[model samples]
Target: MRMPEAVTPAEWNKAHEELMAKEKELTRAQDRLAAERRRQPGVRIDAEHGFTGEGGRFSLVDLFEGRRQLIVYHFMFAPGSKRPCSGCSMFVDNLGDPAHLNARDTTLAVVSRAPYPEIAAVREQRGWTVPWYSSFGDGFNEEMGVTVDDNDSFGLSVFIRDDTSVYRTYFTRGRGVEKLGTNWSLLDLTPLGRQETWEDSPEGVPQESPYAWWRLRDEYGD
Candidate 1:
């Protein structure tokens, strides 16, 4: 990375204040976007969907755990695979705690096509405490648009429960999934900023091939 020229505190503060104004504007724009997202109309899901978990068979409605809202992370763990997608694993590893979400009447869980036994084994191996379930044979992943051509894909879907009815509020995939990773958010504040080739960093800033640094939290050194 190219080193920034040294400057006096007064000069640095002037530049910092200028950036702060743009940052505040961006924050307001994001808030407006979130408000619009909540205002968007949602579609009701009527078809019965089942999942297998440690607690036994569960229906889609049961996933809310009596909460008003549910967020499902579509984990890319194909049936019989020894390891899940590294990107998915990295995204999930940053989900620090669910209690904060639960406090807001939102429940988050990971869903995959892998069998419960395989899901459980990986959960144990990764030391993750978040709720996870298997959508094998139920077509939940496909119905949710998280599986295409029999290949598992990463996605985040939001649902709302009202009385006996459930509606899908929002869904996103691909790079949109980056919002769930705290690592990227942290890196964006640094000089190099994630070191991805696609980033709009200054010329001569160091960057690595995308996904080269990705590894499961437990297998970081391996």
Candidate 2:
């Protein structure tokens, strides 16, 4: 394997400074992108998607926990599967404290299509605190475009509230969701990101089944 060549201090400093300039430029561009995303009009969430958690059955609005914004990770815990999705599990592990998001009037929750008791046991065993819910057989996953037929895929959906009415602000799937630490940042990447089957992506852009392409990171080559 090739390694970076050792260089004199002055050469290294100059190279680092050059890279920093481009990084800063990228940061500014991201700021502009976020400004535009905030302006994008939202679509009303009319589907009666039901979710159940340890507390009991709750409407989609309840997932917001009274926050104005709600970020949901559509975890790929397919029904009757004995193991949770490795990729989705790692995504939850990457999340920081929910309190910080809570302070900003946002709540991040993990939703899956598995039974409540089933997912709860996994959550407890894994020692995860982030709110999790079961959308089992309610067609919520199908509506969100995360589950196509027998395949189960992972994605992120963001919602915001206006007085008791809720709207879907954004959603993303595939690597479109990579490297995003904050839910809002991830959602802002596309107006209707990741053109995948089962996705409500309007006409325009190529798409395929949501659960067809992705695999555990290490299994990609297989």
Candidate 3:
């Protein structure tokens, strides 16, 4: 690897302080972005949508579980698939307990096109306590733009409920979902910073093939 130059403690502290200034600026910029996101207008969800969870059938509004806000993670698990998407699994592995989000009057859940039985199998195997539901036989996935041509795709959608009505506040897909994964945030703190081929790491820095390290939580070390 292209190692950093050997420096005295005083020089190292000086460099660290210089980087801290830019880091603080970046933090403020991120806060502004979040504020802007909250201000964006949303659309009313008037049509009914169905989902099957551990407790049987439910509507989209029911998924909110009486919370004012809901965040649904569209996991890419199509019908008849042997397993869930590795990427989605890895993303969910970093999810924290939901009580904190629930405390904020928000509910979080995952939805997939896979059958309830299949969804339950994986959830149990992974020991995930998060709520998950199946949208099979329902156009919810397609209507939400998370399914295309019989293929499932990843997405994160936010909704707000007012009285008896619900509205979609925001929807993000593809790389936009990265921010939800704490794994990436933790990696960003390391000198190698994800160590993916797309990263601008110094020459000779260790990097594995992209997605090579991905494995189901239970599949690793086996």
Candidate 4:
């Protein structure tokens, strides 16, 4: 297997220093982008949809769990399908404790078109404790554009609320969701860069379409 070139310790340090400069530049750019995102206009939500989950029924605003900001991970599990998207499973597996995000006034949740019973079974089997709610019979997923043409698609949505008004602040999907995972974020720093089919990697490096190899966390073979 071809590996990156070996260099003397001094040379390596110098290279690292140069890369650190670029890394810092990227960090500043990311900060600026985040600031810009915070200022982006939000779309006010007027319709109400019911959701069923842990404590029973809830509305979109209730999903915020009393927090000012709500981040919902749109899981691709359809109402009657036993096939849960392996990519969505992996993404949820990578999430750390939500308490840290809660400390900053944000609540993270998962919303899917699957019935609550199905959601409960998957959560129990996979040991996921995040607050996931069912959008079944509510048209919430369809309204959010994740259930377009009656097909399930995965994404993330951000919302902010006032006393009685809720507005969607942001949304992301595909590669935009990749940065949320430590595994993907670390891989992004490597030369091969996740080795995904869509990435512009060097010739001969291993590559596959995203989710081609994803599996439920516990289903991975040793």
Query: By lDDT, is 1 or 2 better?
Result: 2
Arrange candidates by TM-score, descending.
Answer: 2, 4, 1, 3
* Model 1 poorest ten-residue lDDT run: 184-193
lDDT tens digits, residues 78-157, model 4?
A: 87877678999999998876654554456788999989999999999999999999988988888788888898889988
**How does model 1 fare in lDDT?**
0.76
RMSD (CA, Å), candidate 3 to true, equals 13.3
lDDT of each: 0.76, 0.77, 0.77, 0.77
Against the correct fold, how does model 4 do in TM-score? 0.80
True-structure Cα RMSD, model 4: 13.2
lDDT of 2 by residue, 1-222 (tens): 999999999999999999999999998887666656655778897887889998899999999888777888999997789899898888888887665455445678899988999998999999999999999879888888899986999998888787679888778888966777663354344443333454444455345776554444345341
* Selected candidate, larger lDDT, 1 vs 4: 4
- Write down the TM-score for model 2: 0.81
**Global lDDT of model 4:** 0.77
Is 2 or 3 the stronger prediction by TM-score? 2
